[model samples]
Target: MTAPPAFPAPHPSPLDLGGRTALVTGAAGGIGRACALRLADAGAKVRAVDRDAGGLEALAEEAHGLAGAVEPHVLDLTDLDAAELAAVGTDVLVNNAGLQLVRPIEEFPPDAFHTVLTVMLEAPFRLIRGALPHMYGQGWGRIVNVSSVHGLRASAYKSAYVAAKHGLEGLSKTAALEGAPHGVTSNCVNPAYVRTPLVERQIADQARTHGIPEERVLSEVLLQDSAVKRLIEPEEVAEAVAYLCGPQASFVTGTSLVLDGGWTAH
Candidate 1:
């Protein structure tokens, strides 16, 4: 049999995001804020959206000193409209807005469950649908969804949060396949317990649930399943998001980048 012909090596892309715009929902705090700052530092204009006007303004102020501009919007992702999103004209979209509720399925309120689903899963779907037109027109775009380790595995008292995150990952994978023809990529970052305000709140909830002291919750609950003893930092998750949005990641899509310090390794 004849040997197969050698394949040609691919050339590197020349697209540096010097003037590109990125829309980051929940950009006022935690991993979202870190991502906005890092993208701005890399020369991408950032449109920071959050329900908290004061927090959004703070992010914009901090980003003003970076290489790119930051535009703050006090918009709630739960009530976002396509027209308003299109007006921002973003080259990249980061769906990071989410809420966590800790309650057994039996005790979970209908309204709260719906609220979590809307913010975590439904809103991301809507944003992706709205953003695709611009991405197709430009023939280049990136979508990064901030999922969680819970997306893959489950625990008690987080039925709504876990379900939404798992759904978000599936949605991202589907979007990636659809966006491939338009040079757009979609992926999710699944981080372990990060020391953000969200996780801090969970600590309290977990302590209450287990009848343990708050100080022992991290060691006994959050870090117990991981090989690493420490909680993840928001900046670490931000780094993963940056990589997914960079030119180097052009071929990486329809995947979940897990930053769990080996939490899921087992």
Candidate 2:
């Protein structure tokens, strides 16, 4: 066989988020905060939304020195009316707000299950539906859903989380199909356990559930599936979110970009 030349690597597009407005839910926390910062750094006016007013304010303060401005909003995604969310005038919508509940399916509390579903799945759907009119009118928009590797695979004692993430993926796919003709894109970044307060809380729960030490739960349970054998960094996921929101990803939609560090490779 004849030798073939190697393909050149593609370069990233220059930052050009100027004149754009992005609304990021859960912007007060780990991955969400990173995403907000990245978007602002790329010159997009960022509307940082979270239930925690203090954290949102902190984020806004941090972003004030960046290329773009941050507007903090203490909005509870679960309780917000559709019209209210639409009024934010978002060009890119990141449905990043989520909660984790760990319990065996048999022992899972009904209220807890419903709450998780409401926040993770239902809230994103409603936000997208509400934001569509604005995006459609502009004829350009991006919707990035921060999902989890659990959306692709299941684990013990995570019935509600898995179900909600799986449902979110389905919803994103359907939205992509519908938004295609409108010059809008919908996709997801499904990451494995990131080293965040959320995952820290899950560590304690996992330790309690398995009757194992927290260290063991982290090393053997949470990171067991990944070939990297380490928790993913929040900034790594944030970078992926930014790429999806950028101009280069115009044709990418209805896809789940897994940041699982080879967890799903097996």
Candidate 3:
């Protein structure tokens, strides 16, 4: 109900999500942890969702004394119904939880594919579906999907992860188009390989698949196309997420904010 600080100043103002409710998935660590803290710093009540209860507890401790609070919700996204239920009444949604399985398509297990698609794609749809009603009633919402470079570029032995991300990109665009009329915005933040446990696990899987040592995964596989040649830190990705949820990115719907460090440029 109050006007945001006047912009066009020498330095842009920090985001202020005072009195808002934000839900961040995979909030136990990595980019999700960073995003949760960033939003809490902006004064949003952050519902931190992840299956790792201990990690969530640690996150709660770390978030102590922020402008907002962290409420942990331990649930695996595989439960589509519960995932939707957990999203009800949230003003902002950050769909960051995901999994990866590196193997040739022929070798990719059907169950793993289904699990990846369920968590990374279908659950997000459910959360968006549940959150939309409240958001539409309020006439404002922010939906940020944490996609990956695989969404735009394909690589061998990452069939499940790539497929899910590509689908998420499409879903985000569709949400943007539909939400625009109601003042809700949807966008995807596509980052290249990030230094998270997920990516670290991928390193070992990739080594096994490619028959190369784990040490070469970073230089040869992950950062091969990234001109920056470094694994993006989770905080960097979180900063981008914060920008999208801020007043400045209101007009930035139906777009993929590519933080791939020039991977797609090649």
Write candidate 1's Cα lDDT for 1-266 as tens digits: 11123223223223356888888888899888988888887788888878889998888888877778788877776784742464345788998887887777898999999989988888888878888888889999999999999889998899999999999989999999999999999999999887678877787788888888888887888888888777677777877888888878999999999988798999
Best by TM-score: 3
Candidate 1: clashing pairs of residues:
none
The clash count of every prediction, one per candidate, is 0, 0, 0
Query: What would the TM-score be for candidate 2 when compared with the true structure?
Result: 0.92
Candidate 1 Cα RMSD after full superposition onto the native fold (Å): 9.5
Scored by CA lDDT, what does every candidate get?
0.83, 0.84, 0.90
Worst 10 residues of 3 by lDDT: 1-10
Q: Rank the models by lDDT, top first.
A: 3, 2, 1
List where candidate 2 sits over 4 angstroms from the true fold.
1-13, 80-88
lDDT of 3 at 110: 99
RMSD to truth, every model: 9.5, 6.8, 6.8
User: Which regions of candidate 1 fall more than 4 Å away from where they truly are?
Assistant: 1-15, 82-88
* Candidate 1 lDDT score relative to the true structure: 0.83
The top-ranked prediction according to lDDT is: 3
lDDT of 2 by residue, 38-137 (tens): 8898899988888899998888888877889888878776685842464346888888888887888899999999988988898888888878888899
